[model samples]
Target: MAAAARLAVAGHRVAVYERSRTHGGGVGRLAREGFAFDTGPGLLHLPAVHRDLFVKTGKRPLEQCVEMTQVDPAVRHVFADGTDVALPNASRAGVVAALDAAAGPGAGERWSDLVNRGREVWDATRRPLLEEPLREDGVERLRRDPYPGAARRGLFRRAAPRTLEAVAARELKDPRLVALLESHALAYGLDPRVAPASATVLPYMEQTFGSWYVRGGLRALAYALYERCLERRVEFFFGAEAVGVVEKDGRAAGLRLADGDTAGADLVVAGVSPGRLAALAPGATGPSAVPVPPGRVSVLLALSGARPEGTVHRTVVHGDRLAELDAVFGTGAPGTGSYRPTVTVLRPDDPTTRPDDAHEAVTLTATVAPHGRVDWADDGVAAEFAERMVRAAAAAVPGLPERVLWREVRTPAHTEAETGAEGGGVPAPVLAGAGGAYLRPANTTRMPGLYLVGGFSHPGGGLAHAGMSGALVAGLVVEGADFRGSQ
Candidate 1:
């Protein structure tokens, strides 16, 4: 969709070649019934990045398109011992107190310092790394400099620990806090032992900048983007799937579609995964795309007209179900763990995502291994996952099962098949064993006139980042822009 919009905005008459029948697949679009949801991504932060996408197309005033509220205490957590922890964005002191209650004394201060340091690195790298494109040696560059136009790779270094366990052991003291912190690593398809510490800053963005609950839903945001694209006169392809790259000699030319049709152009901007592009490439080595690891998977639930009793506008992360957590996220030392499971709830007045008091909804998500790890084609697996997730959600809001009018579920494989995201990734970089750089594909593939976008490309995933990265990659293609210096 970014490719279609940007290329069209760039005067190239663009079209999206998607495997799924919907736009924003998983995260943005829903089907089969009158119900709808931005089911995948529940939290939205970094409005600036989204603004960047709009500004380039004179859509900067996207603010007027939707009613929005910046939610405080972006997350409300229920711990194993039956304690509730609700902290707003940047409520470091409050978070610390919560930590003390759940873990031990002095934990609050300890967390405050760690979070603060992470913020420092975030401030230094957010713009360059998260916002801009990077050099081909992007990961290595971050590993080396990271502060001035470089991010602190200290959170993840070649020799440093890469899993959540290592991060917990090195920075945090308590086992429970470690679990809490490690739970976050699932965003990057990592185990606590192998996950990068820099990821710690992600939560701060919500805590500090706060998350937005747009008056309608994420699908509304997608609709807004689609409208902007239409307003810009960008070409639209509802269910077109690009079958392969159309190459002529050394310079790339256009694309071939699954429908046996060809679209000719001077440039090709692949909004799909780099590996997917590789799969379609006619060649093996040069000008070809690289591979990306599968991203984490989640079990999402949308209970028809059900809201947790004590739900707040902020995200609710139920953390007490340790047995389920192990089944989902795993207890391995980072290398052995499987997936990290999570439960997120929405508030009643979440005008953006909820319906007009017509029906209530609650979603449960768990990060699991990508693709082959789980078989969603089997109704048995999907049903089992749904039952388990519903049980978890019921803990927050009783009688939920009785009120559930419909149940919607998506696994990593479902997400991957729908969006073509690497490893079913929603834009998080994948790394654990070796070089982090190797895990990420370059903005420009081996194919000339071909580029990458979405979360899998450069800056990572999340809607805001994906929107902005689209613009950045478009500029690189249009102006021959060098991306090595991007964060």
Candidate 2:
């Protein structure tokens, strides 16, 4: 939708061909039994990406299209040891105080310092890495660690932390703090043990800009973008899956759809997984396929009660991390293993989600190995995981077991059928460490006139990152290779 709107605004005749009947692929809405739930992303951060797109492409801003509400006390963390802390949104002082009160004396100070350093990292990478087209240099500049850690001097050596885990262990000095840091990475399908120290920027970005929610649900944001495209006269064809890019003289000349119809085009922007893109545009090479990480296991509940006043919108009920991390980040193959899981419970304060004030809608999400690893396609496996997740989420919603009217289980298999992500994987946002281990496919392809957008492209996944990818792709298409980025 971002690319279509931008191109249309640029006075280029634009038409979007989507395989699915709906616009938003993963960012979809589910309405069943009088309950409405956002089937994809539960939280939205870095909304400015879409805000800028709206400001540039149309007279109306994003807020005019979809109402957004800031989520205060952004997240409630329920630790394994039974300690709970609700961290306030965009409040450094509050977060520090909360950490000190929950973890120990000076724990908040350590977190404050980490955020300060994260600010530096964000400042350094925000433009070149995100707002701009990926440098042709393959971002070798980021290969060198940029995390600010305590430096040690020796007779002939200097040492500093390089990974998120190392930074947590060295600086935070609290198991809860370490778990907190690791959870940030884990939530995104990234392993803190391998994620760069700069990954700390995740928390800083959320806290600094603040987490937000569309008044209805995240699906509302997707609908807003789609509506913006329609306003810009971007034509869209549903169920017209492109079989391949029509090539003429080594450039993308048009698209060949599955129905034996051809749509000639000046350019082609593919918002698809790397594997699908390769199949659609043969001979184009992307970054070597990274094993698809685990996808989300969500349990949607319709409870016969009202949302408690002043309840935190989101909660993280930490599980046995020691037993879970290995299973989550280990091999992607199926196996029998004892698994402990971290569960996130979401209760949005919106009447639109439920039948009435007397009823409430709740969602529970957990990161587990992708479908291939545990056969999420199997009803038995999915049901068992859903039950486990619901039990854990009971910590977030008191008497949750008793309050349930009915429940719905959404597994990775559902994601696969909807979005064509291999193994129903949920892509993670691009990180700045591990020697480009997290870099995604560049917008420009060897196949001239063909560009990549969406989660599979440069700047990586997440709603905000995918929107940024569109901005980068649009800039490259409109302004040419010399285009640095959106100013």
Q: Which candidate gets the maximum lDDT versus the true structure?
A: 2
lDDT of 2 by residue, 1-487 (tens): 9888998998999999999888988998889878899999988999999899999889999999998999988999999999999999999999999999998889999888888888888988888678888775747876766776553454442355888988888888788988888898889988887788889889889889999989889999999999999999999899888899999998999899999999999989999987788789876754465788678888999999889999999999998885677777764335425565799999999988999999999999888888777788888888887888888898889999899999889988899888888888888878766787777878888899999998877888899998898888888998999888877
Q: Give the per-residue lDDT digits (tens) of candidate 1, residues 30-134.
A: 543444555667666777666655665654566876556677666666554555666655566777877787667887776666567557657766655655666
Judge candidate 2 at residue 294 and give its lDDT. 73
Native-to-model Cα distance after best TM-score fit, residue 166 in candidate 2, in Å: 1.1
Give the candidate number with the greatest TM-score: 2
Estimate the TM-score for candidate 2. 0.97
Window of ten residues with lowest summed lDDT in model 1: 332-341
